[model samples]
Target: MKNDPNFIAAYGNIPTFESLEEREKWLDTLDKIYTEVNDNFEKEMSKYFYPNGPVIAYGYTIDGVLKVAIEKGQKIDAAKENELYDLFSNYGQNIAVKDVPLIIVYEDLPTPTSRTSSWRPIIGGIKICTEKPDGIKQSTLGFSAQTSSGTKGYVVAGHTAPSIGDQIWQPTAGPSANKVGTVSKVGGHYADASWVPYSNVAAKIYDTDTDVLKDVKSHENAAIGDTVYKSGITTGRSYGSVTEIRTSYDNPLGTLYRQYVAGYNCDGGDSGAPVYVYVSGGVKIVGIHWGGVGTYNSGYSTSIFSPVSGVQSDLGVTPLTA
Candidate 1:
């Protein structure tokens, strides 16, 4: 009531009020008017905003109301459904963990060492050894393999099959491969998989460098909502939140199911990259990047990883030390 001088004078300037009792009376009147007006408004709005059926808005802090857009006519249990409805409705005003939906977006293409402080060069950019290289063009590919003796090995992605005796070289110190190890076995159609002696690299490799290894016992079992990081030869370093876990998908390589996360952008040479989780004191290796499910051009898609537990058991190696 901007137009009402009496209403303004009573509730406006404090010193202007004639007495404390008068001021209290004015405040009480104002509160009553506000409640009545709000109640009327809510009643009117309810008619237009009535929910169609069972669907509910998840993040609201007030009584969860079904939206009109939700599919109508579906039968829902009265007792159980009302409880679900109440949870959403009453808690709608409270901050909701699931309310915010974040999608992976490319702010920039990451360079080596951009995301992690411990990053270093892996194998000084792949140098083609010969002008006419044999056995599948020597393309870089990512791989995770375990030896018969139970040693876990990390592999670069490519169609070239490195035999059991093939000598592999990784940088002894850098953001990428800090330790050198040898190929013990190779598998997969394009020889995309290869095994290394876990014992040889165990002391040299940091747990932060591979997803298949973690030093923290608390994070040994990761779940949804945890934030994770990735280190690779290509695309260097990136970070993202876990969107899914224990999932499966099909690829040209084969049908596979593993833990998955979103937000990191990995490329061809990043196949053997390690996935890490950012924990309280340090980062832990949780999985290995197998392949990406989405296109590389847009770069906002889900990528799959093989868990570190499986990798550890297959390779028969102890976890990497932090």
Candidate 2:
């Protein structure tokens, strides 16, 4: 085609390149144009992003395709796809949600806030609340862990207003009789995590479906294409795939960064639940579920998590894998 004068006339002049370096150099101008347009698109496309109206949206790579990912929902504006198509005409394109390989499917299965009286040995996935609990204040326990000094404890959502010495309880509606532990340490910045020190524990998670205890033998970070699962008292155990990494969301807690978003369903009171994948012998925890797409804080109703790495670094506690 480079030597065909007829083809050149039909299209346009093709850049000539004899080396790989030359090819990249020839494409630099195109790259610059795409960069500038996409940058501006981000600023202008905010109107159609998640939390626009009960939607989940973010940018990430899936199956090697980088996209301005957004959940297709009934509440979203009908013209959103059209607007996006027009805006990205030159720089990019939009794919239908059906065609997209990964998406957060909402189950919205609401479980009662109140749980049983108590369990002799506490575990993750069960509800835990503050002194008030108040249903809203209560959230799922992230997992069991131990401080560097061997102090046994548990982890939960930091956005639940963690503070040292703060009394905690298992089950959302605690009546003091259900007292479990107290906040010993807290995580901040990119990880929405906190630790509650307690003496009694199973060092595992309460599996709702199997109605058995599942061991967490290790911890790992979430990758873009990995399949992840969340175990919460409210939603039970649900599976989804990791679609976003280093994703950021702004809320009352803070603008969390490097967060992971798994294409799974979750609801209120699910926060602080453990996110993980099944390993050879047991489970390797990946993250701690926080809030996602909802009516609050431009929410995406997506399942957002603070990876185990950041959680460990922030709280100075190692997840009890044994």
Among all candidates shown, the one with the greatest TM-score? 2
TM-score of each: 0.43, 0.64
1-322: candidate 1 lDDT, tens digit per residue? 2353211111112223576666445333333332332244334322222242222111110111111111133343445334433333333324322331111111111111101222132211121110114322222223333344555544542122335555444432232343345556544322233455533333121333343333332225344445666665556566676554322222323222233445667665455555666666555556656556433564435555556554544334333343
lDDT of 2 at 242: 79
Best by lDDT: 2
Error of 2 at 262 (Å): 0.9
Q: Tell me the TM-score of model 1.
A: 0.43
Q: CA lDDT, every prediction? A: 0.37, 0.62
Clashes of each: 25, 7
Q: Which stretches of candidate 2 lie over 4 Å from their true place?
A: 1-59, 63-117, 132-136, 172-174, 294-301
Q: Which pairs of residues collide in model 2?
A: 292-301, 293-299, 293-300, 293-301, 293-302, 294-299, 294-301
How much is 217 displaced in model 1, in angstroms? 8.8
